[model samples]
Target: MSITSFSFPTSIRFGAGARKQVAAHLLEQGLKRPLIVTDRALGALPVLAEFRSHLGGLDVAVFAGVFGNPTCSQVMDGAAAYKAHGADCIIGFGGGAALDVAKVVGVAATHEGDILEYVWDHPQVRAISNPLPYFVALPTTSGTGSEVGRSSVVSENDTHLKRVVFSPKILARMVFADPELTLGLPPAVTAATGMDALTHNVESYLSPAYHPLCDGIALEGTRIAAAALHTAVTEPGNLQARSDMMMASMMGAIAFQKDLGAVHSAAHALGAVCDLHHGLTNALMIDTVMAWNYEAVPAKFDELAHVCKVAGGGAAFVPWLKTLKASVGITGTLASHGVKPEHIPRMVEIAVKDICHQTNPRPCTAADFERLFQAAM
Candidate 1:
């Protein structure tokens, strides 16, 4: 196996009311003005009011147009907003969508190039700019760990092609994980987001990389999601379950950064064409991809036997995934997610283009993606 350097994490502040301290944190870091990038749904007066108060008139500005599957144009718009506001830092304040958008804005606002030029595997000889102002994150949901990650995924508006702008400069200088902020999520939203975390764990554990660090983190993340997703889904008020799922979600992001594989590659493609929620799409496709991965790494699946071992003693990850999917109300397939058979060819082409595809334990051509999409359907 080839050796690789593995970086650990960004600074983090946990527990309730951590968000209330954002102002002081920024003050100590010497950030005078910051852009708070969030989603429209979270921009509602009632939602943004308290968090806004946290900034305490430190010249903080808001740019909440960020939507689902953050697009290149949208990220550019965010970059524009950051420049217009004379912001010197970023505060990501919503789900993964908002987090990714903020990360991109931080990179693009400072760097000089087409955003995709810096994407994984994209051909462009561009270098990062000087220390890109700092970043602080307050994830309103569990996470994609946009706070700790070195890259941010954005979809192209013209083609809806998902690409990532990867660099350690995009990582948050500090992250605030506050459970109280997630209490308002609807049941379906909770389920979808939780399942997205599960996908990351599964993908990370199955990654072909030699990083045993990511493997252990992914395995424990999977266990936490399995133990807590159902409770978090059914009983939204359960604080312990909520916190566990949130931590698991961050761990999912950390683990997958080692590398995500076919599931993310396929999900990114399907998300573009279907205009589907990434987490929900992952929920829909998790079982199919897990089954495909089963043949490639039965022993790895066997190693994860304990995660789903309760249902079938010493079972592979497949049976456990199926049982977990049904338990969390994620029994649907890609077809159920509105992916028609005719969509397979196009989705396949795009999936192969995704950066994550390279990390798949099994190398996939367009033909392989078509086969996976057909099976997913």
Candidate 2:
């Protein structure tokens, strides 16, 4: 067997009022100036104001320029804000896009050249040798679990293709996972992001990687998500349901360290080509890709079905997912979401090139991706 290393080193404070602890945590560490990196829409919300109220003695600046999908420009722009504010720490306080940009803001602030040059695939990837800002994450949404992630996915400005900056150095030093922060999410956003969390667990478990640890975490995460996603969407005020989904989301993020599968490859492709929300793309394509993937890993499917309590085991798992999506208000296909048949070719090309599918239980050829996109449509 080949040598493999594993690490799960994030400090987390999980509860209803966990966001209140961020100020104290930073003060104890002697970080007085914090730049809160968030999306424009979230910045305008009362939740951010409430969070700010907790940081009474600290100097805080908001960088609310992150919007839509995260991009290289956003990371660089955030770095500029960091320097302008003379921020000594970073407070990532939104959904995936904002948190992802926040993760790398320190990299851009302290390093040379474009932030894209630090992506794992860059030919001469820059080293993250400098000490990064003290970073903490408070997730307002449970979908991407960017609060706990070690990598950031940013898109190119012109091409809009996604690029990944993978490194342990950029990982949040701490995570304040407060489910109350998610209580006000719109039903649609909750549903899409919930599905995104579920997809992460499902795809990570299905990946043919050799990490049994991730497999276990993925299975448990699937069970939690299956039980709580609909309630979390329908009754947004139910803190218990929200909390379960949040924990499940973090578990999915942790589990995917084993890597993901073709579903993510397809989702990334859709995000790049169609500019669809990442989670929504995953929700749209999950059943289609899983139906195709079932034959390759029947036992894993059985395990998933068992964890999710599907009556007919592996054969019923895909149907269960379809039902779950419908229950959470994630209806319609790729075409219904404005994807055309003409978009399939470009999405397929991008999917085949995405690294996530390399560990898929079944290998995906360009032809396979073409079929998947066509079927999803």
Candidate 3:
């Protein structure tokens, strides 16, 4: 495949008190009524109520029905909410799922068919011709980096598989990287999400695609995650650690514009087949996947080792990752997370079709995916 142009378009406001800037930014854009798309749990939080107080003058409607993995129906519902409130803009106010729903809702509200019809590589999917509403993302967690991403992963209702919708039109116009908002996350969430960010950086760096910009960004992002993830998880109130993790997450997303690798493919399958959290699945499977992929790019693994401050290179990197996962309180194999022997065949099938693995340094076949699943198990 021929390499092409690249773009980093999101305007970022990175610091404490950045969430407080949302109202002024919206006003500057002439956006009056904004629909807040977030998960049910976050919507019920007192923090959400408090955040709404910042947009007192603007008419804002909250659609908190989005849950675990965003489904096609939820995206449609979010579109309905956007229409019902006459929203002029969208504010993605929580984690990856909420942000993904918000992005797709913008398209679904103005488009003519089911949201699934726009999925990347779908048989009946259509081009995204309609312009999405103005969008702003405020991620409450330091993972997924969906805040700056141009693609949204939505789970298909029929297949229970995750499908990506990639469109430049859905990219957030503004991103508020406020560490204060992530302070309330528990240790488990912090660990899982941090691992997700790290996986993005690692997998992208190992991908064979030729994008120097992504390569550099992935290296730095990995370094930042290595240094900050443990602290962020253990001491959630540490703003500096939180800030570093958030930066790593955003940088990971930016780097992954080139594409991801087998880790993401396996993780996507896990999310689809077992209904697992996207980040958690990635966290659990990355080391196993890397072990299988190490020989394909031993030099890259050495570089990764040096960047992450691990003592050894290549195969030793896997143990370092395991140590990091344990230190951050993320434990459990795929089987422990609900993957069964019966699920392996279907998981491999889904993984073999995942687009992320196309860029993997090593070619991954269905048999390789089966072995990876078994290793994780």
Question: Which candidate leads in lDDT?
Answer: 2
Distance from true position, residue 314, model 1, in Å?
Answer: 5.4
Q: Model 3: runs farther than 4 Å from truth?
A: 1-7
Cα lDDT of candidate 1 equals: 0.80
Instruction: Compute each candidate's TM-score over C-alphas.
Output: 0.92, 0.97, 0.96
Clashing pairs in 2: none
Off by over 4 Å in 2: 1-7
Q: Please list the residue runs of candidate 1 whose C-alpha ends up more than 4 Å from where it truly belongs after superposition.
A: 1-7, 313-316
Rank all candidate structures by their TM-score, best first, as comma-separated numbers: 2, 3, 1
Per-candidate Cα lDDT values, in order, are 0.80, 0.92, 0.90
* Steric collisions counted per model: 0, 0, 0
Winner of 2 and 3 under TM-score: 2
Query: Which scores better on lDDT, 2 or 3?
Result: 2
Counting only residues 3 or more apart in sequence or on different chains, how many pairs clash (N, Cα, C under 3 Å) in candidate 1? Answer: 0
